[model samples]
Target: MLYKNSICFISFFFLFFFMLINFFFMMFFIMENMVLFLEWEIISFNSMNIVMSILLDWMSLVFMMFVFLISSSVIYYSKSYMLNELNLSRFIILVLLFVFSMILLIISPNMISIFLGWDGLGLVSYCLIIYYQNIKSYNAGMLTALSNRIGDVMILMLISWMMNYGSWNYIFYMEFMKNDYSMKFIGVLVILAAMTKSAQIPFSSWLPAAMAAPTPVSALVHSSTLVTAGIYLLIRFNNLLIDMLALKLLLLLSGLTMFMAGICANYEYDLKKIIALSTLSQLGLMMSILSMGFGDLAFFHLLTHAMFKALLFMCAGMIIHMMNDIQDIRLMGGLSINIPLTSLCLNFSNLSLCGIPFLSGFYSKDVILEMVSMSSLNIMMYYLYYISTGLTVFYTMRLFMYLMISDFNLLSVYNLYDEDYIMIKSMLLLLFMSLISGSFLSWMIFSYPYMIFLSLNMKLMVVYISLLGGMLGLLVSLMNVYSMNKFLMSYNLSFFLTFMWFMPNLSTYVLNYNFLIYGQNLVKFLDMGWGEIYKSQGLFNILKYYSIIYSLYQLNNFKIYLFSFILWMMILLLMLIL
Candidate 1:
């Protein structure tokens, strides 16, 4: 209790501090259209320097304020969610470290200092993911850690590549390196690193698995901070990646990721996992937009998405907590009756996620769709984005129907209350932000509005997709109850869509199975066969043979010794005579 109170106080204090700083920075930017770059030398060696620096522009300030705000909210939320846990202090400490790491990454302009935060995020996330001390948590932590390590390794390589420019400060060199063929590999590496951190297609399995963590961690790490690190990194490096071939590949993969995650979320039953997949879908959206050279739009979506996604997770936490830790949505229905406030928050966040007009998600998502429509993208890319957009609405509506409108499916005679003031208080803060963050950020960030000249259909593209998706979602939800039993029973197409086209299986079993089998074979050959023969058994045999020969030569048998000496002397005499 003492520790929880301490954490809550500290979190509120930091929230106030960062909010004030953000206000000042916003005013400063309004007065002068220049970035405030502050640096203090940490270490300097011949041609190798490491300096701690701050890049206080509008982007960093806004993002930092968001991070601090979300961190503070999650910490406050944990006060009730984790009040019963004995090791609450440890959890609070880990959360604090994770937030600090994110702030470090936010301010850094140098690759060397960025690495400090990058690696810190990966390491600390692993600890938080496994805080439950269960096998599931262990497996999830390993998956999350190893997946992020790929990006960390790429960052180290990027640092080495940047060293060729005589400085690790990428902010200063990004524009100059834009056309340098030598820096092309660096750009590719940066994208690959971002893919891993952002949970882009191939690296996506870890994000859902990371739902094994507590809800507060899910809200903070999965929804906002840890996963966004990659997107944030790319935003900082967008100048160099604008014209690279790698960006085209990123666009395609991110589109596929967006579509894939949306389909999977519809199929997922676990409440937290559903929200996790939604985060994956939004991440893909951000990456796809970034690839299209609208990095500001991507960053805008990122900030808005964070506000609501965190609230979404917090609401899910309340549901899970009330349900006695049951996460299956099939067992959850009519929550609006028992927990009306939480239900309202969930519905609001879900609608926002579906890009409902005037909400936080709509501001960025609607603009992104408009921008993509106006671009010269290929037909296939166009379909991927629009289809993914539709799927987002479909899944969100389906989730809302399951948890709110449908009849309560759980056993009767149970308490389901929303009287936890601490949890509700924390959620109310984000709920208010989710309502206004999009328009607020749009007005703050865009001094001149986007020049979105388009045909009528192009202007309404997002609206068309969203309406179509909402209708389909309603049909699917209706089918859940009213369809013929046999028809509903034989849902092969739905099966494919629900399993995310079997991506989770492909990632977890197929990929890892092949590697593990090959690894076992290699271990057998090295540890038991040729390696043993040459390195252990063969050397042992040779040493034994030499020892036996030496022992025989040292034998004190008179007749044997005399015979050996005579034979040696005769051989020497015969050689001399010859």
Candidate 2:
């Protein structure tokens, strides 16, 4: 029975792998030179006259390579991690399905095809997220699926609108959008779709909630695969978004998301949630940079973030596996001796996460900072770049210290290295790749910005300051200055603690608290002011009162008969037109 099972598994695995490989290459051959025709040959669609197939030669290749590498590693990692487990074959099938969908998403000929591929992956991910079949996993998966679907619904509507206007049929839609004034609306809707997939701002809560998934799922979902879909959409539609005011709104949203997530990561106790929120924060920063019109920088960051973040999560998984699935930092410590290799990889990844000089993260992240300075887009971006860079280092180092150095020994009750060598090998491979991939890709993308330019040079002063700021954060982490013990001891007097109790009041007085936190006061002021302006006397209030009075007056049946007749006539006219 065992031999038969082994043979069957191997046969099925090879079959699925080769089948997908063949399908993708086949699609590539057919569409190799197929220009992404928007509309049949209708009206004439011309955006830049630059061929998308050729433009995709480099960027699409980079993303496809990432998809394959990560997916392959995930399968390999799961092999050892799930050994002796039931439903193994089903898991492998899902793995192939995921790879197939993701690759299709990358190579898709147009927005519609890309979306089809994207939605397919979203479906696969929902199943994967709830794979454990526990209630919490189900709940988290449901929330994640619903959130992603909301984005999808917006995207579908936008696509339908674009198709109607012939944008999908660009030469197809030119005649249509030319008269519609709806491109702007569709563009904004598309960005909203991307934002949710990318986990920006208000839609971001689901991402961290998704940590309930198995560690591998968390690693795959957060580290530049699922979330990166949003960035990909924006990049693909760069020309359209360039002139939209929605781009600026997206930029501001990204900045706020990056800042808030970094702060929350600093407060999280679960090891997975720390990395989860960090992924959310980093994606936001990348989106902000891209929104500022630097797709190259965004792509570069996407690359490096994938490498280091994956390495970190896989290492976290190893740690959790050893501790019998304990994920809380409060229950971990002193694993440096027990899991030396894991510790080393974790430290290096953390350095990259902190954007230490010369690490992969440094090259990609600092380049965005440079762009912020160099671009004539917005002066306000400078503050966002500076402060978020600092927070990135702070929270990253804090998690590192808490997990590897701080004197928590609750994990002593459990073993801390039960993982198989296969898992460790996969992680080490990622770390090794991450150590060099960023710099090498940096050179490639930078030299070819029009084709592949990935800028390496940032403002020297800003780079220096950001590096120094990260170091300061590292120092604070090393000193254990912000340990939970300290916070608990002074819980009442703690600013964060007090603010937690009076959230409503703090929100109300945020304007008065200006200048305390870098952007908190400003955000508070805006929210409060906007709240009072809208809630107290905004147009909606007037409309609400009007609605009540109108309903009561309608009860009198004065104009009821005439209104009903007119409404019926209008409905009949609309129906006839349809």
Candidate 3:
């Protein structure tokens, strides 16, 4: 009991301390020229020096404020939500640990520090996901941990490759890359790491599993912190990733995933699952922008998505908390009459999420579509993008209308109007910003002089059409449940259903095969005159499935035992005969 109480006390102190430091530093930076830095004790090895950079920049400062603002509010929101929980102290500790790692990730100047924070963030999120200590939550945590480990390994390999070629310092990597191909290699691997981290397509299953976590955790994981790590990685290395084929591949995968996720979200009836799928779709849009070499546009969308999604999720949390933890949208109806404030905020955030004109999502997402429209990308790629934007609207509105004011006629046995003050305040702040000022932030980050480029009527038409498609979906949602059921049954769309199930898996397959495109690379098989031991099937799937076999065959077995006279003589005889 004392230990638990002490943990609670320390967490409160740290939370207060974090906010105090944020306000003070933000104020000081506003009034000063140089960012204040402090030196701390360091560890060393033989002749290797590691310097910690504890300074702030515009980018780091913005992400820091984002972290502190969201995390502090989440902590406050958790108070009432977790008031009766037994493990509140442990929860608080994990939340604080997450906040610390996020701050460290954004501000750290070196790869070493960035990775330190990266690992910490992953660890804390894994713990939080499994906090309930249930079978399902444990399974989800394990899967997500494994996926994150893959991403971590990619990042580590990239760092190691850099170390082998030159200095592993960030500044040094940047300077050293001006004339080296190694940068391209490292950039490709880094993008792979980002894709896995961002839960882009094939790596996306971990996210829905992550929903097994508490609602506050789902909000943090989906919106601002863990998943967005990939976008940050890309932006941090934009110069290296730009104009590369791998970059284009990333864009394509992101766009396809976004479109696919929207479909899954449409099919979903679970409230949290809907939002979870939408998160994947939103991040896909951002990654698509990144792939298109529009870092500014991607970053802008990321910021907007973070605010609205966070708000939507917290509102979901409040509802779930009040209703004794039911998440099915099918079981919810007429919530607008009971929780007017939360419903209103939910609608506003959903509107932003759907990218209605003048909303936050509209501003950022428009810039991305506009940029892709102007690029030299092929028509098919551009069309995929167009379809994705439309799908975004369909799912966002479907979730909103279904959850906020459906005609399901389900009865609630729990109260829905507690309106805890701290939770309400946190949501209200997010609602105000999302509704009023998120676009202004976009404008600041994405201000580029208008260039006279050819008008992309195709892209523009796609956007309008996609927007209309979403409106059509909303109109359909307004129909009675019987009609919705009839429409679904009449459609009898096995392909769509199968696609929804297979798309995420397909994405993972692509990643495993190194995202190789047909007509780009081919694998060959030769069996040292062994009478065609295995058919050299030209299909990619078969070849990829046999990579291990090919690798083993390539080993230099003779070099393992040169002193074996019989083996050496047979090898020489075979070579002479060949």
Candidate 4:
């Protein structure tokens, strides 16, 4: 146990040291406006090259630095959270593997090598999700794995498609591929791949289901590394997808995802799942921005969102740990009175997530909203973005009211304490980052500033929506006197929002039920009917009959032998006459 704790400490130090070094490297690159690329061929065949490569620009460097930072913090927090568990070493190793995979993904310029990272992430995440060894964890792990496997399959197909160009390095060819009409199919496939990873629309179910994992895993995977992978991929390929009709479709779907996740999060009662849905909502926001050609803006939000969202999950972890793993928000209230520091962290992270002014989220989210307003979009698209933003504020406020402001709901016999300095210390690092990362990254990434020339109403659009959402959120929380009865009366509407419009059912049962039933029937028919008679049973019966007849003939049945000999002679004579 002491050795395991030492390993955690060493790992955290190593990651922190690397993060500092990368920070300096990022600053140097920014000063020189330089991009560093290095590659070595692993296989060469018929002018097609497969290589391991790295692309070090401001984007990859900064993103990798943040990944390491968050990973280090999560590891530190887990030392206390999982201290009593027997598999401490195993947990640390899985997390380290996850971080390594994410770094490989961040650096890779070649699609083939990217596959190594992408599939590594999927596999490692599954291991982490099912670490608890329970039915819920196992099911969630399967869903997470299978859903991501779709993206992996698409990526494999993409590698085959890119082989047409005789190179697997997408970075080198993105500009050329931009105008090539024949490569539009590749762009579509790429969008589908991103959709599955980022949890956009139909792929959104897995993200919330994955809340069954430990909270630290949720903080690392869902908040920063795993879910952001899709957005990162799209950001890298944004130039190629800029003009494709697929991006327009992506835009619509992403917008809908934002709205849908926001609505679902408001109705969710599970603390971790609520935060998981919030992560999903933010992913949609990033995807929507990327689809509109604001790759840098999307990337900006991705980084900032990572900081606050990870912190949010960590805070949620602390709460769930204190509450003895009780996750239902309905069973939790007035936690601020007991764990003030945690409540502070939770509220700050939530506010940042809601785009509160001067925080990390506001720096990126506000700009993204302004950019959305300035873009040439349809009215529905415009409304969805703003409405989704407002809903974000609403759900966050609702969560805040439920967890921090309401009356204490737990039994008096239970003791609550917040003396876990290790967890608190880990959270403080991200709490600091969540406060400043947005402005810091925004200044670093954007060379030429975005110009937003909009009318007065449009200029304050985000503010207006935020205010309205805040008001409604407060009203909803405090006005629950008769609302529960009314909600019970309107069961269908309540059920729809609460279950994310049956998205879990859609993905789990509706999607697989028919195919599963058909497969079962096919198996039965093959085993009991055609396959049985034609292959095993029929062949065995024929062999047995021949053996029995031969035995009878060998048993000195002279009449049978004579009859057989006469039949053969008659057959031979007829053949000769013909």
Candidate 5:
């Protein structure tokens, strides 16, 4: 009862207070040196020393404010969402642990501390994903864990690599050895680790799969905790690690990731999976921009995206709850009438996500697209960026129609109502942030705004792509089984896109097939060779059976003598002939 009522409020209030303090610090740092540091020595040895460090800067402070703000709101939201569960306390504790680990990751400059936080985020995320204890959640959790475990290994290797520099504080030496072979080696390790955490390309399957988690966790995971961890790491190490070679590769991979995730979201039917894929798409955009050495732009987009994405997930969760946990978009329509406030919030967040002008997303994404246009990059990347941007609108509008514009499609009673005040209150907080964060961040992050020069055609390219995408979305959403069922007509293409380019299939079944077969063979061989023969009970039973056979033969000596005489005569004849 206390947990259901008070724990969230306690955490929420405290985190809100801390957010204010951090925001002030962020402003101060921006006006001053833009970065500061603190260190606390934990231990020292003859040649080795351990120190814990905190990185306090405008960037870190801003990230901390967002993390604290989003997590607090998420915790508050979860209290109402998970009210009926028996293990509510456990869920709340895990959420707090997740936040603590994220804070560790956000502030730490020391490699050891960062590793602790990095590994902690992965471990806690696995626990949260399987919080429901179902087979689906279990499978999702395993996929999430093993995929992230690769990043943990890479971080460990990086920690050892840094040992040659004689300090566990990676922040200290990133600039000093930026061009050395060992440093580039470190960059490779960092990029690999960040890729797994951020769900780029091959690791992307886990991001969507992780939707098996509770929706509040989704709000946190997608917003600031799990997926953004990688982007944040890359932002911190951008100048230190990523070179031209790494940049080109990252740009290519992240651009594909953006395109792939956007297409999947458009084809997706599950409400939460669509949102999850949307987060993946946005992450890719951030990574792509960062790869071009625009770390500030990436971070700007990251903060703004976190605001709206959290609200988006919350609104989706509210609707899903009203629908009795049904997440299929096909089952939902005309919700805007029944749940006006919730629907309004949902669409606004969705619009922000589509980068509608003046919204938080618009300020960041417009700059990113313009930056891409002006930069000296190849035609493929330019095409990919715009095409993916349009796809974002396509999915967003498709989802909008399915959620709000279509006729009512519910089979059960329509319980969709904007009555959950507790949930609404937290969502309103994020809605306010998503509305203003981008504009505020744009003015604050830079002393002078970015002046991008482009021809008129290129300047309007985003508007053009968005309009085309909106038309595609409208067409896709309006098509019915009686008119045009794309799923059935082009089932193969739909299946391929919806399956996230068969990443899950390749990652799970195809990749593990030989290993699973070998394991099965090993089990069979062990049981047949050693286990079958060496068992005490089996050995005793065999001896007893043979002794019984011998006793029976002795009792039947006359019959045995007749058989033996015939055998002996044949043998003697053969010997004589020889």
Candidate 6:
């Protein structure tokens, strides 16, 4: 059963069944508006016990449904995408491992338990990304693993801090210590961990570089599982994080992350990398909205974005297959004529991603934009929010033009086979969901309608900017390569955009890039220079060498030396006796 037949079919049906179960449970809990908490003590000793706790609520149930939905789709799609690969079983196993970790992370409110799931996600993600066994993939995996370890360390520190404060269960403690001044430090540590895990500005390089992984893995990871873990944590901990001073800093950094990713996607040519950047941009939106004290909105966007993003990546994988694994968007076009079904899925998913009207992404993206416009946030935030929204449209339109509307630029003969149907089946599942998941989820999530009051012009601004970004994208894509390069385009700006604000150069494996360099200089100065001179071993070595040289003089007159030594020994004894 494990190897003779299709493992994808088995896992797909299993996860799909549970996803429906979760959806039912989520609806029941929402209707009742109740949460169930269970704790079992395995080893009890004093105040601390080996008891792990589990929380079941509508929120967790909804998240689990989305996770299962996307994961099953990805696994089934991988069946066709990886048909020739020898280790298909291993790939399926890793995806299941990640889902388990994500479920662990979601239901546990204890810091100690969260770390286990958190670390598991990091470990499994690293393994999946480097599944290719190449230099680039290995380096990307290292970056992903090393960057996430910072968040893991933060969680460990939080565990120690919480243990000393009386309980490992954060839910109980957080509810009790809502307004304590001492909770600020905990908030700081928690935000740091979330930022690292979510790939906010400084930690974002790994997300794009992670495109080295197979496209199916990208569909699972970048959509709802790995990157969303941090957003989930923040949502779980919003009680502690709200009204803190660090939240303002988070707002600014998250806005910058959104703006940066949006701009970089337009400049990027790699199809997977463009999608990766879009994920980063959406992550920034979630974090920013969460920082604004709307966990519900963030969670809303998270689920909706997951549906469309997964479908988008799956369609990209299908196209990349048509291009013989060529991810360069410049060499792709007119796919609608060939694979009409895949192209339709890709186009709808892209529109959903662009927040086009009535699509799944629109329900979330529109709410977020309206919320941003209505909030009394600072001017800089307004600029970042609006401009980034426009840039997202720009990059998405540019990618669509390069892939669908432009001429068919593939040099090789394009062919479609029967195995391609496996991918289409899974794609259709997600494709149907992506179209309607947002409205259904938002209706289920909010008890009452959101009240958004704005002038006609303010409402039109979002539409106007989106149209402008789209037109600009079309114009730029239509320009001849030499003409576009020869015009006002500055090579320096292009290079900066290419490298994503030089973040890779700035993010070190150990932690901060600055700290990495600072440590080397510290070692060079203290441990190797002045420290060596005063070290006991150094002084002893120098004295030994000099003593050996002095022994040569003693050899000149051995008897005289012996007599002198004997006299000195006698004199020392006399002085001691006296």
Best by TM-score: 5
Cα-based TM-score, every candidate: 0.87, 0.73, 0.79, 0.89, 0.91, 0.87
* Poorly placed runs, candidate 3 (over 4 Å): 1-41, 44-46, 412-414, 446-463, 478-499, 503-578
In the range 476-510, model 2's lDDT, one tens digit per residue, is 66665568447455755555532223332332235
Model 3, range 1-578, lDDT digits (tens) per residue? 56555665456556656756765665556546345544454767888756676657545665676666667667766766677778888798788888888878887766778788888878999999999889999978877887888888887887788786555555545654644788888888888888888888678788887899988878777888999888887887887776788887887888778877877777777788888888988888888878877776777787788888989999999888877687887778778888889888888888888777787777777667777777888987887777777777777767767776675455535566845876798788778868755666654443356453556675466568666767867876787755665666655563455246665456445555563453234332243222244454335457787996767556866654464667889999999999
Instruction: Decide which is better by lDDT, 3 or 6.
Output: 6
Candidate 5: tens digits of C-alpha lDDT, residues 60-99: 8899999999988998898789989888878888998998
In candidate 1, position 104 carries an lDDT of 89
| TM-score of candidate 4 versus the correct structure, residues matched by position | 0.89
Write model 6 residue lDDT over 21-45, tens digit each, in one string: 9998998999999999988788978
Greater-lDDT candidate between 1 and 2: 1
Q: What lDDT does each candidate get?
A: 0.88, 0.72, 0.75, 0.90, 0.90, 0.88
Residue-by-residue lDDT tens digits, candidate 1, 1-578? 77668876787677768877886886687668878899887899998756678888888888888988888889889988988998888888899899889988988888887999999999999999999999999999999998899999999999998878988888887786678876889999999999999999788889999998999999998767999999999998898888788899999999999989988887778989888888999999999999999889999999999999999999999999999899998899999999999999999999999888899999999899988888999999999999989989998888888998898888887799989999999899999999999999898888887888999988888889889999888888878543643465568777776676766687667768888998899889997889999999999999999999878878887887898899999999999999
Question: What lDDT score goes with residue 330 in model 2?
Answer: 72
Candidate 5 ranges with C-alpha deviation above 4 Å: 45-48, 481-490, 528-533, 536-578
Minimum summed lDDT over a 10-residue window in model 2 is located at 498-507
Spell out the clash pairs found in candidate 3: 202-507, 202-508
TM value for model 1 = 0.87
For model 1, where is the 10-residue window of minimal lDDT?
Answer: 480-489
Q: In candidate 4, residue 209 scores what lDDT? A: 84
Better of 1 and 2 by TM-score: 1
